[model samples]
Target: MKAFQFVEWQRPGEVRDVPVPEPGPGEVLVKVGGAGACHSDLHLLELPAGSRSFAPPFTLGHENAGWVERLGPGATGFEPGDAVIVYGPWGCGLCMNCRQGMENYCQVPGLPSPGGLGGTDGGMAEFLLVPSTRYLIPLGDLDPREAAPLTDAGLTSYHAVKRSVHLLGPGSTAVVIGAGGLGQMAIQVLKALAGATTVVAVDVSADRLQVAEDVGADETLISGDHAVTAIRAITGGLGAELVLDLVGVTSTLTMAAQMARVLGHLTIVGVGTASLPVSFGSPPYECAVASPFWGTIPELIEVIALANSGKIRMLVEHFGLDDAADAYQMLHDGRIRGRAVITPHD
Candidate 1:
């Protein structure tokens, strides 16, 4: 099996031949069909030695979609050759969060907290071993490349938008910042699920803003000092009721706060490492700020259904497993307009 691994931090990933993983009890082995390169993967590779959760020599692609190659004991309802999407979050099957179908937030007895490619050997190879059968969700008749991004970028946006849906009324507005992979998905999710009359997207790149508009954003703003003011003007001085910051940097988070109406919600969904200093302002209206993790399994199912129904469209570029470094560089350089997928079959 060929895999791309992190031999060291702040260095290029290495492509090597490793032993193919086998399914253990209650586990399944998936032949990698497609794995999306997430921004977090780029960040993990750039981590300055001591800040990373997982060390070197780990396979690092999490957003996985493939066919079941082998199934272990007690892995019922799925058999070899069955098309499936890996849920990516591994957790205890009996925990409270897992019981509620929120395995992404699992924190319970006898199980470690769920972490995807960052914590375990992921699917940037010919074969991926799913630690639990519960993480497998069947993808009926959908292309694996399209389903790959839904595991993380799509689900993360879905969860972030779901939080402030009530605020995005017919007359209300929303502003999505940094129109990258997650930002592009956020626009589609806001249009499909939240009925915001005004969907404004902000980014430094015109191409990304164009992608955002093509998806469903009512307007796009080139991010800068004028971005927040532009959003406020579009909302008729009240500003948007929900502002999603997909860039999580200090500037974008500050702009989100500046563009949100009093009593509005600002959802931070990006993985950038910048910090924001929060303070009370004049005529404060109970502003709520939060950071959302990858969504629950049921939410992933809903997102898949949304894609299956043709409501959400995925824009992807395919790369071979050997070109993992190029894929990472494309993402780092903002050269990818949408999601970049690695197909192990190559």
Candidate 2:
């Protein structure tokens, strides 16, 4: 079986042949239907060696959906040939957070994080071995190939928007920074789930901003030094009631802080490592800033339901497993308009 693996730090990932994994006791093996290529994978490879808890030689696709190939002894509730989406975050399943289905914030000690993000083996392979049946969510009528990105890009954006939904009301404004894969979904999610009448999308690329407009952004702005001012103007000087920063760099974070209204919600969902200084008199008055990791299982289910209902649509480009490296290159170069899904059997 061919697998795309991150074998070395600060080096490009490679495709190599590996043995197909069989499901062990209490585990399940899934035939890879599709695996999403995410921007965070580039950040993961840029970090210095030993920066993350999990090492290389692990598969690298976190957003995954596939069919059940086989189930191990005692792995119940699902049968072979069942279509499911792999919940990327693998947790201890015993902690309070995990018990509540927010395993992305698992508090257990000495456990690796989610799959593909410095954790266990992921789905960028011919087959994936899921540790337990708890992580598998029914795909329903959604095509796994088109549904892969929903696990992360869709679910993560849904989680962030759900958090700040209280601030989004009729005539209120919601700002989305970075109109890439997640940003595109965030725009649609805001339209589908929130009451905000005005949704603004910001990005460095005019093409991406156009995509944002296509997805339902009431307005689009070229992100730059004047972005904050434009957002203020759009909100009639009150600033946006809710701002989602999908690009977490210093400049974007600064713009997010400036664009958020006093007492508004600023949610950071990108993996950018830029640090923002916070002290007395810093940031907007009473503005709440939060950085959520990923979505919960329940949230993932909701995201899938939204997709199944056609309320939200995912724009994706398909690539074969052999072209995974090229897909990553396009993602790093910002050439992809939306999410890229790797189809192993394509």
Candidate 3:
């Protein structure tokens, strides 16, 4: 089988030949239907050697969906040929968090997690070996090819939006920063789940802001020095009650805090390493800030349900396995309009 992998640290991943993996006891093997190309993959490639908990030479697709090729012994609840989405974060299944489906916050120490980006092999190849059948969510009637991005891009945004939904109500305002793949879904999730009458989307890209508009943002703004001012003006100087910073950089984090109302919530979901110093005078009084990692398996199920019902849609561009490098290049250059999915069998 041909797989795209991060073969070396601080270098671009390569497409190389590798043997196909078979399902082991209590595991499941899935034929790769689609794999999302995430910005984190690019960031991983830029890190110094040994910086990541997971070493190199592993397939890199975290957002994955596919059909069951085979089920190992004792794998129940799903049969072969079922369409499913692979939950990206694989944690030790025995922890309290994992027992509650919050595997993203797995607490077991000194154990490497599974799945792409988590140290285990991912779904970028012809087939993927899922450690347990529990990580597979039934896709129902959704197309596995187009449904891959729901695993991360959709689930992450949904998790963030779900947490702060209390702040969004009649006459409330919600601001979404970095209107890219995750941000677009965040916009729609806010409109559908949050009762906020005013939904604002901010992004550096005019194209992405346009996508925000198309996906239900009531207002779109080009992110810059003036973004905070524009948001305040739109909100009658009260600022937004909820600010979801999908791009967790210094500027966006600063803007999110400045644009949030007192006692509001600001959730950082992006992977940028920029730091924000919280103090008495930095962010507004009583405002709460938090950084959430990838969502839990239950959230992924809800995201898939939302996608299945057509309330949320993912805009994706397709690429074959051979063209996976070009796909990553396009993502790195900011040319991809939405999420990019690599179709291994195409």
Candidate 4:
């Protein structure tokens, strides 16, 4: 079997022939069909060499969907040849957070955090060995390529929007910054689930803003020349009730804080790294700033259902596993509009 292996930090992944893994007890082996190249993967590759999270010689594609090749002992309720979506985040099952279905927040010590791909052998290979059967969700009638992005890009957006749906009631507003893959999906999720009266999308790229408009943004703004002011203007000076900043840079976070109403919520879903200055002073209103990771297992199921029911369309661009380096380059350059999905079998 051939797999795209990460050989070094800040370097292109190497495509090499490797032994296919067999599932252990309580595990399953999935024949990789489609794997979404996430923006976080770029951060993983860019991690300084020998850093704590920079583990090399491992395959790196976490947002995955494929068919079950074999099920190990104790892996019931699913059989071979069943199409499934791989939930990549795994944690200690006994933790409180994991018990509540929020495995992404598990508090167990020495346990694997919810970060896969870099931490574990992920889905960038012909066949992937899933650690636990619980992480595999069956995708009925959903194409692998279409459903792969929903695992992370769509799920993350859904979770972020779900946190502020109460504030997004009638006559409310939601501003989504950075209209990339996750940002565009956030726009759609806000329109479909939150019932946001007005959806303002901000992005530097005019083409991305246009894509946001096509996907249900009430208005779009270029992230320059007072982007927050434009968002406030669109909201009649009250600012948005829920500001979802998909780009977690200092500039975007500052804009989010400035463009939010009193008692509003600002959710950061992107992994953009930037130092933000904080000072104690008179603030406009009470606002909550939070970073929402990928969603829970049930939310993943719900997202899959929405995609299957034709409620939320999956915007994707297909690429072969050999294009892993090019995919990351396009993502870093912001050249790819939708999620770039890698097909290992292609």
Report the error of model 4 at residue 96, Å.
1.1
State, as a TM-score between 0 and 1, how close model 3 is to the true structure: 0.98
State the displacement of the C-alpha of residue 335, model 1, in Å, after optimal TM-score superposition.
0.2
Residue 212 miss distance in model 4 (angstroms)? 0.7
The Cα error of candidate 1 at residue 113, in Å, is 5.5
Show where candidate 1 strays beyond 4 Å: 108-116, 282-284
Candidate number that wins on lDDT, 3 or 4: 3
Per-structure clash totals for the candidates: 0, 0, 0, 0
lDDT of 3 at 94: 94
- Mind giving the per-residue lDDT tens digits that candidate 4 earns over 200-250? 899889999999999998888888648877877777888888888888887
lDDT of 2: 0.90
Ranking by lDDT: 2, 3, 1, 4
Give me candidate 2's TM-score against the actual structure.
Answer: 0.97
Q: What digit string (tens of lDDT, one per residue) describes model 2 on residues 1-346?
A: 9999999999988999989998899999999899999988998988899997678888889999999999999999998889999888888899999999988888887653777776577899989999999999999999999999999999999999998888887989999999999999999999998845689999999999999999999999998868888888878898998899999999899888888888998889988889766655456789888999888999999998999899998999999988999999999999999999999977
Give the better candidate number (1 or 3) by lDDT. 3
Task: Check candidate 1 and list the clashing pairs.
Answer: none
lDDT of 1 at 304: 88
Q: What are the per-model C-alpha RMSD values against the true structure?
A: 1.8, 1.2, 1.1, 1.6
Clashing pairs in 4: none
